[model samples]
Target: MATGDEFPLPGSTYRGPAPHFARFRAEQPVVRVPATGGGHAWLVTRYDDVRAVLNDVRFSRAASYAPDAPRFPGLFQAPPGMIISLDPPDHTRLRTLVAQAFSVERIEGMRPRVAQLVDELLDRADSEAVTAPVDLLGRFTFPLALTVIAELLGVPSEDQERFSVWIRQFAAVDGPEDEAIAAREQLGEYMAGLVVGKTAEPGDDVLSALVRARIGEDRLDVGELIGLGYTLLGAGGDSTACQLASSVVTLLARERDTWVRLGEHPEEVPAAVEELLRWVNLPTNDTSGLPRITVEDVEIGGVTIPAGDAVFVSITSANRDEAVFGSPDELDFARGGEHLAFGHGIHQCLGAPLARIELVLALRELTRRFPAARLAVAEQELRWQPADMNHRLLELPIDLHGKGF
Candidate 1:
């Protein structure tokens, strides 16, 4: 069995590629690792193997609730009716209701608004004038993400600061175990209250839609409603926040040719955003050892994952697998849509549409406005949260053209 010390969690520290993950993927694509909560699990890293485990019904997501199921102590548990934690039938039904809210057409409708938000942020960045030091993570990515998600959920604009505070505490990577638990409960209560208010006066927001919708008299209860809110905050906010910052930083770090090329072809923003998603691969550690207990024996990559065993899928490694992606480490905007940043199978990220819209708008606007932008600081001097879960930069001091775009 691999000891807890053998495999470092995704975001533990940034020392090039994760040593444990690299080693494990090389020697053993699937191996047992000591669970954070207890027992052990089989961590799957290869591209094909990870996809198989994700799509396999014999591997149950609901198994996380089993009496002896192993899981991280403070990780948020999906309430009943929340699609993330459910398997078939119920999962299919619950997901369908929210699916329309994130459809291609619905997300496309938000493009102009998303572009406006991006323009506003970039305008602020330019207002500072000169090559002023700015925290892209805080000033640009976080606000943009928070604003979009708040609007989508119909959260009051004035209350966003409060919502942000709750999210910070709720998603803190390092905290006392009890503190994380307390934060979760407090955030849940807050969401519960918000849901109640939305129910009383239904609005045109996603939350209201969820509250008013029904499936044969079955609807989201308070807990599940709050859980959905939490999911949006985490997925809809944090993931995009990190990715936006990382994309900006990565783009500027490259030759001026890349920025010029992108700016010249703004229509390629969608493809560029796809490349960014694959390249940055945030939330790598977010799915840490979130094992799906096997309902029956299964063979993957020639290895047998026995029944009742916990199977962990590593999204980060899978995206970089040599067998699947050519020159896997290189970033190519034209690589098309072969990556698994949104995951695979039924449980793929529901917020993917929103995330794509955010990235496309942000990147297009940034490049168009600050075509000459370049990193003012050395790559080695940049700071990041000490984990693979968030691909973010604490600050992105840049020198841009004096004239704002």
Candidate 2:
């Protein structure tokens, strides 16, 4: 396989994923490339090849996290006990323990609460917008995502503001290395305390459940508990927050008809949300969804990746694969099929159900409230978060345009 551009590439909020992803998907499904952080590894762009890599056990997440593992230059290493760094059956065991909290029943149970939160947030947006355009990323999306996850995890509502600061730094892709490290350490310490508090005064929230959750005879140790907290904050809060902001921007600014369509047919909002998730490629620099290392020689897309090689699967590109979704770049809610936005296989996003609920509710309410919402600033003038693996808007400044009613 030929080598492509350096991984991580440069962070560009104004632009989307590298155009080379399309070219590579059309030509070389798999190729090696210099990692943005430092080292070089295989970059897989095709939808089929990416799905194969994610589903294949030969491509090991554990090996990718090994101390002696090949790394993508400057990427932050996963701390011990973080579930994302673990391999099965450890991963399976840990996932099983927390899976109940995110079960279909539990997430479904959250709909009313989530909708209420969205309504309150939009109310606040309206109040704030009386003077000027409100930045939804801060005023609505970030708070909504973080608050929901915090409430689920038993984090104090008052502390969410503080937690958000640390999480943003920790999740930033272009932030200083020292600041990120500091943020992680600080957040870890905070989670440790939070877990202990929950253990002592166990509540009805997810973290309390996790603190006491068991898989037969085993339970999460303190380290694992802390790690899980970290995961939830970063994954549930950070990623989903970005997704929410991007969804609003994409729907309102780029796909206004889709927005109008959903507003007209509220029943189709769920399917529309899925399509938006697939089509909106926030500014991303992480070529791979998360770097995986080949446990052995594995052939993907006719190219063999030997054991110990870091492989990055381009999910953004896969979601846009022309083979799977004709006219891949277009956002057609009616044109739906399986997409890898939430990934596939064992490590598929654990919070997908919650994210879907949040997005659906947010879209339903936003369309109901502000069908005419439009960007207050030019699309080109908007800035994006320089986050690693995150494609978040720095702020979604928008005018509500006097609400839908």
lDDT of 1 by residue, 1-405 (tens): 334463335333222245566666788888777656566668798888888888899888887788876665534444444567889887887787667456677677888888898888878877874546555666788999999998888888898887887776667656555666677787777787889999999887788888987777777777777878888987788778877877777777754667778888999888888877776756545243345889899998889988888777877787778777787778777887588888889989888888888888887777887787776677677877553235556666666662221
Across 1-405, the per-residue lDDT of candidate 2 in tens digits comes to: 235546665432322466777778878889877765566778888888888888888888888767888865455456755788777888889989878666688778888999899999999999988878989999989899999999988888889998999987887756888998999899889888988899899998888888888877889888888888888888888778888888887777678777777777899999988887787775365344567888889999998888889888878888888889988877777887998878888888888889999989888888877777788887767886545567777788888884421
Error of 2 at 378 (Å): 1.3
- Say what the RMSD of model 2 is: 2.5
For model 2 the local lDDT of residue 139 reads 90
For model 2, state the Cα shift of residue 193 in Å: 1.6
Error of 1 at 1 (Å): 11
Name the weakest run of 10 consecutive residues (lDDT summed) in model 2.
Answer: 8-17
Q: What is residue 395's positional error in candidate 2, in angstroms?
A: 1.4
After best superposition, candidate 2 residue 382: deviation in angstroms?
A: 0.8
